[model samples]
Target: MSFLQPIALLGIALAATPILIHLLNLMRHRRESWAAMMFLIKAKENSSRMSKIRRWLTLLFRTLAICALSILLSRPMASDESSLINFSNQKPEVLMLVIDRSSSMQKKFLGSSKTLLRRGLEEFEQFSKSWPESKLVVIETVFSETVILDEIETLFSREMEDFFGPTDSGGNLPFTINKGLNWLEDAEIGHVQILVISDQQESNWKIRENEQLIRNIKDKIDSKEGLWKLRFLKLESAEINNFSLVCKTYREETDKFHPTLLITGNQKNTQSLAVKINVNGKLSNLKCRFFPPSTTWTPAISLSDQPPKGWIKISLPEDSFSKDNDYFFTYGNQEMLKVGIACKDEHTRKFITAVCNLDPERIFLNETFSLKSKKLKENDLLMIQGFSSPEEDSQILKFIKAGGRVVNFPDFDGNNKPQTFQNWNAIESASKNDFFQISEWNRNQGIFANTANGRELALPYLKILQRKIPKEGETLAFYKDGESFFRRKTIGQGVVYSFSTLPNRDWSNLGEGFVLVPLLIRIFDESSESPALKLLECGESASLEYNELTPITGNPNQKPSVNAGIYKELGKFFAFNRKTSESQDEMLNQEEMKKTMSSNHILWSEARANSLSFERAEIWNLFLIIMLLFLLGEGLLGLPAANFSFGAKRQ
Candidate 1:
């Protein structure tokens, strides 16, 4: 048996008090000699044994009463085996179901046909039957909205299908739980049972990064000791052989279209796989070999003489997880990428202009302009090298909100006045005879990612003599001394990149054009009109303010936020896919889970795919009844017994 308040068990020491008092009373009796007293004592000797028996029984009952009271106060819980008889009495007044409908939950166990999500729903449906009077409320991951159900049967009805249906989005377990707690606090429900059904994927939990959130949740649960109970129905599978595909980026040439794909799986050996390609409804297949530990693959598709604006679908062989097996992408005709340069230093401006104009085909429309001019909205990307005035800062912000990317270089004029967009610390330079070298970066993604053919960038070869540090943002690349080389901040829909060093001979060798050219080109491509709208993570498309969106692929009636598909709004096409984190194979182990949810009020249990039994129940009422019964027995034994004669009555 477990306890909600184990400190109350210290009261069990009171049980020995009764026995100690009985021993003291016996020792207090002194021997007395008298003719009359001796005769009376002899007459009652036969009944002395029976009186002694009743006295001992009274003491035993008193001790048991104290023991039961202690156990009752501790709030003991019984396991399934012991709680079978008391299951009906364990109904809670409020039942809040926090379900994780992330993409990973769609995976099925090895050799099992039912998905983890389906198993969770079935388990909850069966358990809710035992609490027929509970007020059911659900919080799903996709929307994280508090849904009040009229009855438990409504959970399975067609009207509530959207809440329980599959979703390609990743789950925010902490945020969803917080939302449920907020609703419960507003409703002022006393007795609540929060049942969280999830696969315990680490990406969904994010235990380390969300320390503050977890602390707040723990404090809230601790404040309401007996009023709330938290339980987890973890549906964990043993096998980890799932294959996931991700479309990192796509390129279009004269007669061929290349789509860069990332394939990640848990298998440890090399294997051959077949990928199905669907280009505007025409189906074909390609054979590829997968090597363990290597996850990059680039495939080229032959394009016909059709219009460049179309959609492509890539599908892998069905594996343990079906949701991540397919990837959707939409392509469009290439347009000239416009770039605006606002640099105070002549050398910095010339270097950047040269790199932007390196493409011989004139794919880039590079223009030198001042930030004071109100022509920022037309450009796809803006490169600023120095501080700007208040008016220019406001215009830059508005441009960023309208989906314009910006790259900020350090100010060489020592003008450190605060700007509205971002703040930077004083410039720091390397010591004499020493230089700062790039030590680490995210090579799998972002501007400095590997080439389409899986070649690393030349960031490590660069040496930095001077740098500036941003006050706040995510560090994309780090120097040898743990300083940030590149930082990124996402403002609205656009991103701002901050480079610590300038692309000049004085600051670093970034002007060598190997790293600078590709970096600028990737950033320029990302700022295009179609790339951002063409591919998006699930749940992001729902936030768009588009008035009308027609389905181009998948179910026409389904919401884009809940499923992966392609849609068209106005004249632009958008493709929604599951978040890449959902494809990760890391799961929370038992130790980590215990550390994350460390509270007496919370209880977690592992569940098999087909198990339907409730694992735990609070049996404090059983101890309460036991304590009352023991007290009643003690009272009865303390009462005086009536004297009786077997043969004759004394008159």
Candidate 2:
């Protein structure tokens, strides 16, 4: 049991008023002696006692009424396990508000500029103003973790101005809700109410995959046994006809730059949208027509004459959501790398050159060395197909430290086995007739971007007669037998890659198939673009190897740089936009929400909800009813004498 207004309990002293009045009346009365009065006093002694009992009964009813009224005025809230005697006054309530400040909450109505977040904050301000005595703690859903904005004491001090500011990040409701519940547990307060305010986005609240987590949270609240209250304020939605540029993939085709864009629209009727592009500082526009449940438009932009190397900007017409309308891309002209291959056999040298796919002028074989000046250059990529002695190893290590990429293929020459190399040891080979299949590869990385079309990569059928493993490098691809086939090592500013087997028909089938061409091309492309360019979402942070990034727009001191634009550091360009997942329009309906939450939790629509509707166990009306019943009992007990007098007169 708890009291919302405990000061009214002082009225309980009025219960003694009836007893004081009765005692004072007894003292004020003086006994007048008379012959007839003395005789009647003795005979009617039993009657006097009965009349005193009736008076005492009336006084008891009046005192009980006063006590009930006092409790009613105190606004006591009692649980099912609580009684009047068990009521306490120390359970001060802490109102914790978890609000969603993501950009998805910026959807506004058709005729008004007010958004869901704006209206929801207005309703929350009104509700919080009504509870000036309660301590408020506010947590906003952020990109990293749940951020505590306003502490409990600040709300009590009447210093709150804005409930939530504009944000560029998307909401993460599950993380924030769990954080609030944990804070309540640590606080150990008697009365707590968690008020969640959001538009009920499925991207925010759908945790069907985390069923056990949801069950655990439900059990925690039930363990409190009515000490905690969970309530939700669901915001309403209006008409939405939003179009967004999901993403764009840029590539070099022939001597020109080619770009393909993926655009998604969510609307009821067909709409015309203007698409703008700035390629190599040349501006152009394309008109797109879309109709939807979900409609995707794929448009290709091709440059006939090779445009000058520069940045590209794609944009869409602004609507209710302006965060996802723009995109940025950077392109560079191909600079053929000078590559050299050191191999003992002619077949291996030709195979390496075929995989590289570079022009003949830039591709050279080290086996045809005719002079001492024909050694590997510092800026050239060196593919070593065989190893000779410790002196050769020393020269390769020195070349790697000078900012060069080294792709080493295992060598099995006369008297020098693969295990003779330092820092590496080769065990006995597996069954000779058995095959090795790639089991795992990094998907998020661009190296294997086109490797997998489904759940698994359709790799070439290859059988390995010999395999060598590295001792110091991260494995990028693994075989079915849990052996590494490809590994990467970093030395100074350069990188080294070790391929367990050479791309030869005698050792493996990977050389005879179609996987070697693009794989080699991508490696060259990735090597040329050292420290690859990334397109990040707005809420994420960037860590660069060089401190040369300058903000072209927006404040650099402000984290996350909510404004979408292009940033340049040194000669490289980066693109940042709002989180792509926020473009989804899926939401949970009322019945779905009911199934997702526990029975102890309550949900209300912010469109028609108020603060007083969720008050705990309102017993003031019950106390008023009890007071009226006691009043009726007092009147009925005092009426017995009148009935007896009427009966005697009638007789």
By lDDT, the best candidate is 1
lDDT of 1 by residue, 391-469 (tens): 9999999997777788888897667775666788887778647888988876766777788668899988887787777
Model 1: how far is 234 from its true place, Å?
Answer: 4.6
How many pairs collide in each candidate, listed in order?
0, 0
Least accurate 10 contiguous residues by lDDT in model 2 = 154-163
lDDT by residue for model 2 (1-651), tens: 556788999999999999999899999999887778867877678778988888989999999999999989999775432456865423437767777876677777324567776666665554444344667777777632333435433432432322355555666676677777887777776776667778877766535333555666667767877767666777766776567776533556545555544566676687777888777557889887765643345555656564455566778998767667777766663455656677765566788877665545434334443212335453457767765555666666666666667777776543334322224445336565566667676542445543322223345355666666665565777778766777777675566877776677666666774555655666665565433354555543332232245655455633333445566767666555566667666776667656756565444445543232233466799899999988988888788563245556898
Candidate 1's displacement at residue 325, Å, is: 1.8
The local lDDT score (0 to 100) that residue 122 gets in candidate 1 is 73
Candidate 2: lDDT over CA atoms?
0.62
